[model samples]
Target chain A: MPTINVQMFEGRTLEQKRAFVKAITEAACTTLGSSPESVDVIITDVKKDNWATGGVLWTDKK
Target chain B: MPTINVQMFEGRTLEQKRAFVKAITEAACTTLGSSPESVDVIITDVKKDNWATGGVLWTDKK
Candidate 1:
């Protein structure tokens, strides 16, 4: 039930995404003690303008 | 890839989730014109205490 969603800055290659999914899935299995099959990792490449933190948009703040 | 993430109040059945995924997938395909296979929807059921909006936690604010 440990469905991990990683929202990160865009411009990553397909290979980089595959690596991140693999690593996060392994970490979930180890830390959360869940089966690899049960874990679903979804990567959402968000544009800087679409994300915000601490009440400031990433693009504007960055 | 218009991956949809629906974050709502938890305690829904598996059937409900399946329905949500199916509905959202179709919507993505229709609106975004993306392939169903390319659409990956991940549901993250966060605790009420874990989420915040307008600088106030959901649980505490609610």
Candidate 2:
């Protein structure tokens, strides 16, 4: 079983998440030889203020 | 660098999250030889409806 956690900005619709998870499941199955049903995708809706890159928060970026 | 994703039920306070991340970062430093700054701890607050075990959704469990 393979568990994947995706961190992205919030505001995605349920339909968008459904499609995203479907694509991830397929990719994991094809590349890792894992069963589609056995793959778990957990999406973390991160706020810009909470995520930092290169020592700078995304909210502070231009 | 080590990135740890923790999946737990929601409703934790800010202090709890702070302690959790601190503990995880320390553990990674001890076992994986990763620096505290390089160990990223991402906590995913999963809803019962979105989590499942043994083919049964957590929301549907007793």
The top-ranked prediction according to lDDT is 2
C-alpha lDDT of candidate 2 relative to the true structure: 0.75
> Docking category for candidate 1?
incorrect
Q: What are the lDDT figures for the candidates, one per model?
A: 0.69, 0.75
**What's the DockQ for every one of the candidates?**
0.04, 0.12
Query: lDDT tens string, model 1, B1-62?
Result: 77666766567889999998998899889988999999989887754443333223345543
Error of 2 at A31 (Å): 1.8
Per-residue CA lDDT of model 2 for A1-62, tens digit only, reads 78776778977766566667767777777888887668776667789999998999999999
Clashing pairs in 2: none
How would you encode candidate 1's per-residue C-alpha lDDT over A1-62 as one tens digit per residue? 67565677988765565566667767777887877667755555689999989988889984
Best by DockQ: 2
Instruction: State the DockQ, from 0 to 1, for candidate 2.
Output: 0.12
Q: After superposition, how far is residue A21 of candidate 1 from its true place, in Å?
A: 0.7
> After superposing candidate 1, which stretches have Cα over 4 Å from the reference?
B1-62
**Winning model by TM-score:** 2
